[model samples]
Target: MAGRRTERIDEWRERVDELCYDGERVEHRLDLECATVVVTTQRVLAFVPTTAGPAFRHVDRPNVGTVTLETSQRLAVLCAGIIAAFAGVATLEMATSITVSSAVPSVDLEGIAPLPGSNLLVGFVETVLAAIETGLLLLQWSVLLAGVAALVAAIGLITYYIRSRTRLLVVRVSGDDDLVVPVSGVDLEDELVVDLEAAIRPAPESTPALEAEDGRRTSSRNWTEIDHEESG
Candidate 1:
């Protein structure tokens, strides 16, 4: 049983690695539940699990251009406020609807034909009551719809927070595509960036001496041409 469990765990890890990098051996790994970053010999891979599905991106060592970090506190607070306001309004409207529905008395206009002024008064009261009920019903529905919209917006904001609240590691690839990975904390961010930079920084070029030689040759040729023109 122990052997089987160990084998299963290994298989699961292998599956996850394959899903991200097609069997690349992971040299460094940071797991954040919703997001993960895996560094291999050849590339850095970021995986994000979203509502639609799991999204993954791989940045070749040579193609990594830059890394950045950011936060989203203001947007999160704004979304929370909107959600609370809509929820409060919805509750208030619902309570008002219930009270009005129960308190208002139903009137019957079927039987007695009364005095002329009495008839006008009765019709006016009926119209007024009906308008109030209709307005309350519409108001309740409108508030409910508003509450739903606010709830959706709040959920979206929360999702964004979950994906971005932590120090976000934003990797810019050579072709202008960016791969964002959320790290758990600032320490992790610093450590990961250091590791990535060390791994991906290109080796220093040895072409400076060649470039200087080429410049010297070009200058000598120009001087030779000028001397020949003067002689002619």
Candidate 2:
């Protein structure tokens, strides 16, 4: 029989371990690029890994006060601005430097020197290459500009994908400071939010004798919700 390999716990996991109590265990975890949001049996943990060490914060499940969202489009706007400037400069320079050339020189024989036994003079112009036509030059720059536009569009898409996704969750506790955790991807975000709500908000206790149509709403775990709350 082959033995199973155990998962290694690094420094970051150690930090996560220290955030929990002796009996508290992690229930749901959403791992992001630099941060992780964990829903534990008794708490919610926000862990950020850095060069020096792991920075971690947590709040008791019942003490959670407000959960807000912070969204930003600054990076996307900055990228668009910088690339627009670059494209303007590049197009202007090309327009100024790409003028039509009409200095083509043609060679004409003044006098003929005869060969040894023949009255014919064999002429060979060393450099007789014709310059590119004006229309063709313009067309070339047009193609180059198209290529540049394609490149800029590609960069814009890439920046939108990477730098523009700065959505985060700001969890505020009753007396503690807010814990900020970066979130990405729809699956992770949905699952984490669901687990967090389940952990904090209690489910109604029901027996077989209680019918749903005849029961009134219980207020055991009732909490007020502040919608559309923005955080920085």
Candidate 3:
């Protein structure tokens, strides 16, 4: 049983090497005690390839990596809030100005129109009301434009948050979701495999293994063990 287990481990290691060199996504099934690796252009999700056909729910999910949901949420919320707040402020200012202008007194100009030298203040109220109307129309148009811009920005934020928060992931043997791995670091042709290999490799330990041997060569070597090892 031990030898069989060792053989299986060796086979898995070899497969891992192949996966590393080929730059393919590999699903290591700890539950089933074997691994299934496949190469496909489509991003991996729940299904994995098999000789018979694609296997659904055959492998255990990997939990190796972390997702950055907070950053995306923060950025989208910040952008949307700024746009909405600016639009609200502009709308409030326009409303206040319109209200203040409409409250002013309107002096009648038709009563004093007979005199020839009364032209200066003759239509002051009408002119003021006309100017206020024109200003209100312009302000309404500006508010409409700002509202539309804010709505579009809010929609963009919603879209971004939805995409960033949720994903269809396929867990690899290394306990990582292979689908969401960033491919920006590598060329398109080699990115898939390179990222898979990077995910599977174990972190370096405090003790270093010997160059030619499987055992660790400690910094302080025992002279007696060296002499006995030489004799043996």
| lDDT (10s digit) by residue, model 3, range 1-232 | 6565546545654554333335445443222122233322222222222213323322222333432211123565657756775775676566545653555456777778887766866666578777877777777677766766776676676676655652212334344323322222122343434554444444345444444343334423566688789999
lDDT of each: 0.66, 0.59, 0.46
Instruction: Compute each candidate's TM-score over C-alphas.
Output: 0.37, 0.41, 0.36
Order the candidate numbers by lDDT, best to worst. 1, 2, 3
Mind giving the per-residue lDDT tens digits that candidate 1 earns over 23-129?
65667776664466666767877666431333556778778777666553567566685676577567656655575575556877655456557788788989889
Q: Where's the lowest-lDDT run of ten residues in candidate 1? A: 47-56
Of candidate 3, the 10-residue stretch with the lowest lDDT total is 42-51
Candidate that would win on TM-score: 2
**Per-residue accuracy of model 2 over 37-132 as CA lDDT, tens digit each:** 778888877665432333666677888865656664566666665666577567656655654554334445444444462333323432232333
Best by lDDT: 1
Candidate 1 residue spans exceeding 4 A from truth: 1-27, 50-54, 73-166, 185-189, 203-232
Q: What is the C-alpha RMSD of each candidate to the true structure, in Å?
A: 11.2, 14.3, 13.9
Q: Give the TM-score of candidate 3.
A: 0.36
For residue 116, model 3's alpha carbon misses the true position, in angstroms, by 3.4
